[model samples]
Target: MPKGKRTRIVALTRTRKKGLDSKKKLMDDLRSCLEDYERVFVFSVRDMRNAKLKDMRTKWRTSRFFFGKNKVMAIALGRTAEEEQADGLHKLSKALRGQCGLMFTNSAKDDVVDFFGKYVEADYARAGAVATDDVALEEGPLPDFPHSVEPYLRLKLGLKTTLNRGVVTLLKPHIVCRKGERMTPEQTRLLKLMNHPMAEFRVNLVAVWSKDGVVERLNPDADGEEDEEEEGSGAEDDAEDMDSD
Candidate 1:
């Protein structure tokens, strides 16, 4: 081959390698976006082009909360978490396999909690029903994704809230699952239990951090209730001492 032809071939090969390198770098950047975050929230996406999820992600980014796509995140799960997390995290990864949004923050827990509350409030009005399993299984407060269970506040609790309805109402809202169906008794029971305790999403998520957190570990289910009672009793005892003084 001519010297000029050989040079041309070498230049083309370098350009191709550069293109591959650029693609590799992009993937690495996406993965870094996931791994560097302090917490990972895994969610399922029903609609691939979810406008609400996109909006939530944009809102988080505006507030300096980093959001990333899940396919990229799944890669991090595969590479980062232990083999045990692989099954559960991978299941979560599969749930998030399609287009979904993520929010990241190194900010205070309250900030994250506030964000969740706002999101849930926004979506509550528009959502018909949410999956009880999903809500119960979530690490924190229910998401602010619309098309969930905020439409009917009358049926669920046999009570009503002034916020969703008029002052006369004394009920929390009823949630319908996808396809405009009602949640089963078990699901409703779990949701009502969580809601009554004012168990915010972050609180539950924090519980995952301890599997009990503020609640004692011995009895699991019974302990959370007992812990609250103990706190109440302690407060009463403090009040009595103050009265004696």
Candidate 2:
């Protein structure tokens, strides 16, 4: 009898995890920075924005920024004097307990300090953010908005609106948001439509580590020391996307 063609069965293999490899690479890179850079800085961000951070990174092209899990970063710097790769690094690592990152630079300390101290970017506020100022719309013709948006403004934003002669008009004064009050999603949407920006993104230097075995505490009130094994306290590279405007 003639033999029929045989079917081939291929075994599926699971992909190997790269988490450990990534962490090892990060540790190696950090150690290399310790050898290359003159100083290492621990900094925290307020209202972190990736765009602004990338811009800042461009401005400081000579420096290196490392954002990773706090525990992993701490391990890279060493959590104890005996294990530390450099003098005073363990102390500096102690300040990396929260949402923060490291900056390794050869720039003058004063220059780096001045640049970060003066760097502030204004951005739009997001929902759940506190209103920076009162925003109210007076009862009148909203010629800025198209008549097509009147229904959205009335139904979605809960605003009193009407269409008058092909123009969107407010039937009654509407308080979009109050100062010091948490903003609602609708309020944030209205603010964006109105082109209002209220959030400010800034970086705060927490501590500095010098090659001469000196550790300077800049922001003592920052996050306190946390156990290296503490859960749910990883240092995130970026802020929550929901908070982004």
Candidate 2 lDDT, 1-245, residue by residue in tens: 76657855656785554468767877887899899999999988777577777777878878888767788888999999998998888998888876678899999888988998899999888889999999999999988898888899999999999999999899899999999999999999999888888899888899999999999998877553445465214333232211123
* 1-245 per-residue lDDT for model 1 (tens digits): 55764454345445322344433443454446444544444332231223444454555553222123333445544533363222344433433322233333444555665655454312211223444333323222233422234334335544333332222332334432333344555445544544522111221121111111121111122112223222222222221222221
Q: Which stretches of candidate 1 lie over 4 Å from their true place?
A: 1-26, 34-36, 45-50, 62-72, 79-99, 120-245
**lDDT of predicted model 2:** 0.81
Q: List the residue pairs that clash in candidate 2.
A: none
RMSD of each: 20.8, 6.6
Instruction: Count clashes in each candidate, considering only residues at least 3 apart in sequence or on different chains.
Output: 16, 0
Q: How well does each candidate superpose onto the true structure, as a TM-score?
A: 0.30, 0.82
lDDT of each: 0.34, 0.81
- Regions of model 2 farther than 4 Å from truth: 1-18, 224-245
Please report, as a residue range, the 10-residue window in candidate 1 with the lowest summed lDDT: 207-216
